[model samples]
Target chain A: MTLRTESRFADPDAAYRLLVEAHRKIDPEHGPALDAALVLLLANHIGDPAVLADAIAVAVKVVSPQRQ
Target chain B: MFQFAYRRSPDQDRSSPPRHDVVVVGAGPVGLTLAIDLAQRGRRVLLLDDADRIGEGSRAICFSKRALEVWDRLGVAAPMLAKGVQWQVGKVFLRDEQVYRFDLLAEPGHKMPAFINLQQYYAEAFLVARAGELPGIDLRWKNKVTAVADRGGHVAVTIDTPDGPYELEASHLVACDGARSPIRAMLGAAFIGETFEDQFLIADVKMRAEFPTERWFWFDPPFHTGQSALLHKQPDDVWRIDLQLGRDADPEVERRPERVRPRIERMLGHGDFEFEWISLYRFQCRRMERFVHGRVIFAGDSAHQVSPFGARGANSGVEDAENLAWKLDLTLSGGNAAALLGSYDAERVQAADDNILNSTRATDFIAPHSEYERMLRNVALGLARGHEVGKRMVNAGRLSQPSLYASPLSTPDHDAWDAGPPPGAHLRDVPLGDGFLTDAFRAAGCRFTVLRDGAGPEVPGAAVIDAAASPLFAARYGTRPGDAYLLRPDGYVAGRFRAAAAGAIPAALHRARGAA
Candidate 1:
């Protein structure tokens, strides 16, 4: 199945808030590591290679918009 | 308490002693189970132990489904099940907050429960009773081995009994002694690995409480802050509690009832329980360089040890007993002794390594070594409250499961299956007729079995269990009408076939028996 661009959560804003709150609970120095680990963990959870590849491309595009 | 009276045996007075087919040392779960299995396989066993009675306390309380299956083959699972507390759910807590609960066995339609908390003494008693019924088993208590010499083809053993010292000869001598194995020391075999400095206090408390029968584990709870704790309900109104007391706590001072009672009261929030047993232990994850040494063999804790976080000690020992028994029996019955015993060495060493790896990992997670490690652990526990991945990362304990043997005896599968237990894996039990698949396998004598979907092939000298009548079997085994699986004597899958040609069965059987 293609990666769904539409938001799946009933409260997308609350989901975002929860992620931020989780980061706040840990020490400031650990935030980046947590994000990296969470990304890897989520990648494992979303085991579909096509969807993961698509999500990665979309995520990288946000940082380098001009990249072909 | 279960007690066995010491009796005088004629072997003690015999000048030449006696030569036996198999002489098994120590009469704990492993020795008892091994002796029974050998006896069932038509080999006479001389089972010896130094102790006259089962040890007190609720040690090794958690017996896994795999262990129960082993006991079932020996005709002792019924008593174990009837007298033990069965559970599948376990909950984890971080500080005072509950993290997430886990269901060990989510899928149903299995013969045995996921786990049962039976006292070690009761388990041994049942095994002893079963051993007594089998005429091939000659169990002698108060018989301790003082010296063991490997005489190439046979083993010479010197025993010390109440009467005096005696000598015996064994074609195969199996040491099922405990962690501090005297035989292991006598042979001067090296047991290598890590030993944790952290100490944990285990107390078996007897009380009338309405707590649900589930494993409750905690990390830094209010009652016992800065350390982890575990609670499990056992049989006979006894609840086992483990409180982490760091490296500095004096085991002698902590073991006293006066010091232990307050901790129980603080944890239970009441002072209405009596201590049945209490002890302190440090984790030791280690194993011998080789489980098999010349004519003398090592099984159970004598061969390997792991941190008790996963209840793997007794369960893995039971699996060791099962794995070793069949191979030894085949060797004694004029099969290739070298090849078969070599398979045993390879298979059980693989299992011991797997157990040590898992238990060591769990212990590492449960008791982190440094501040950074503790922070990472806390991170996982905190994230577990909101994420499924975090729950997967949290390892209070990875409870004992049967080892999937990537063994030399297994004939690698030649056919493809969508979803089923592959070769070198334990067969998942399914409901067959009135009983279960495991029951049928047990009923079909202790030998290699051919489990088929329908009447496709007739394998000589192997018991056959037809899966045509049971749809559940097909579902579990991922089989059509022509599928068949070759099962080892220890219930491990040796090979599988999509369509049997009758001629292909002998070679697979040969490979499974280590005769290839």
Candidate 2:
């Protein structure tokens, strides 16, 4: 089955709080490595190449809006 | 809390060494259980341990259903259930938000609960008292094994006591010693596996609190930042708190009350608890290459060890006791020693590997080796907060269960059927008569049992039990009137037949007994 992109949590703030808490203890230089690892883990957990590609495209578009 | 005074035995004064049918080293849960099982089977057992009392601490508080079943067969599950805190619900939280909760025992009608939290000392105490009731068991305290020599037919053991040293010969020697087994060390067997560097502080606190008897786990909670924590309720109004204290935390400093009390106070939001026991441990997943070395056999932590995450250590060890007990009994009763004892090594090794694999995965998730791995773990936890997949992926600990042995002794089924326990799987407890199926199995003595739906052709040389009155039995067994099941003495399904044909029953029983 493909990954669910829409919000599944009952409380969205609770979901957001978990993400913020994950990075509160790490150094700044380790941020990209952490984000990359997160992407890989989430990608595997999602387990669909098509869904991961879609996620990567949306992330790239948000990062470089002018290029799109 | 249980203590026994050491007394001199006749063996110490004998000019020649006395020989025994079975000798079990160490008096922990595994050793005591093994000795009791053998004694119940009418075998004389010499049980020795170095200590004069049950070990201090509330170690191994979680007892699974399989473990309770084993204790039930040994006649000690009643008191343990009475004193233990039984629960099925477990909750996991990510920081301040709870990710999800689960019920371990979803169905009813079973005799035992999903899990019970009882101190290790209580389990050992019950087992020791039961051993005292059996005349076949010779339990000696403060008696240490000074040396062991396997001389082909029998094993020679030298013991040292407070009085003096003595010698004895045993047809079978079982090492139920803890992780650092002196017998294993003397044999020079290599215990090979990986060791996780992360440390955990276990504190048993006694307090009167309103917390439910459920397991609670936190991943990076506000009280314990950047680590994991677990809390569970035990008997005597005591709670067990395990906090992950990174790889570099000094165990000597962390075990002190001043250091442990504050961490617990912050987590509980009060300082009303008193410490009953405090200890530190790191995860080690290791096992001997072979559990059976000639006449000497190894069970429990001496044979294998897993991380404390899954509660597999003592639980699996107890299983080993049951598994080995029957095989040893058969071997002593003139059964094929090579074939029967060989299956014990094969089956228990498979179980140990399964336990090690599960505990290793949980340990890796709990204590990630690198920052990159930590990020992956955090991401999994974050997704768990909102996603069903994340909840399934989180690894607090994969709770212990009985191993369905892929044993050489199991007779493969040729019939196409559904329901009931398959061959080599443990029997599920179902209500029958005034008691349960497990109690009925116990009543059949330590021999193969034939369970049939109704009156069927009697199978020769096997205890027969009729399940005609109980519909649950027919439903659980997926059987009609003539169907039958053959159960091993250790309560595992050996074979099942579509019809209660007496001709085919003997062959299945022969195979189950490892008779060539």
Best by lDDT: 2
Q: DockQ for the candidate 2 complex?
A: 0.07
Measured by DockQ, the strongest candidate is 2
Give the runs in model 1 whose Cα sits over 4 Å from its true position: A1-68, B500-502
Name model 2 segments beyond 4 Å from true.
A1-68, B500-503
Model 2 C-alpha lDDT per residue in residues B135-161, reported as the tens digit of each score: 999999999998999998899999999
DockQ of each: 0.05, 0.07
User: Best by TM-score, which number?
Assistant: 2
Tens-place lDDT per residue, model 1, B1-516, is 777777888887787868888999999999999999999988899999998889987579999999998998889999999999999999998777777798989977888999999989999999999999999999998999999999887899999988888998999999999999999999999999998888999999999999899999998899998889999999889999999998789999999999999998999999999989999999999999889998899999999999988889999999999999999988887888778888888888988988997787778778775565666676666556545545666778888988888888887777668878998899798888988888899998858999999987678878898967875888888888877889999999988888744467778898898885
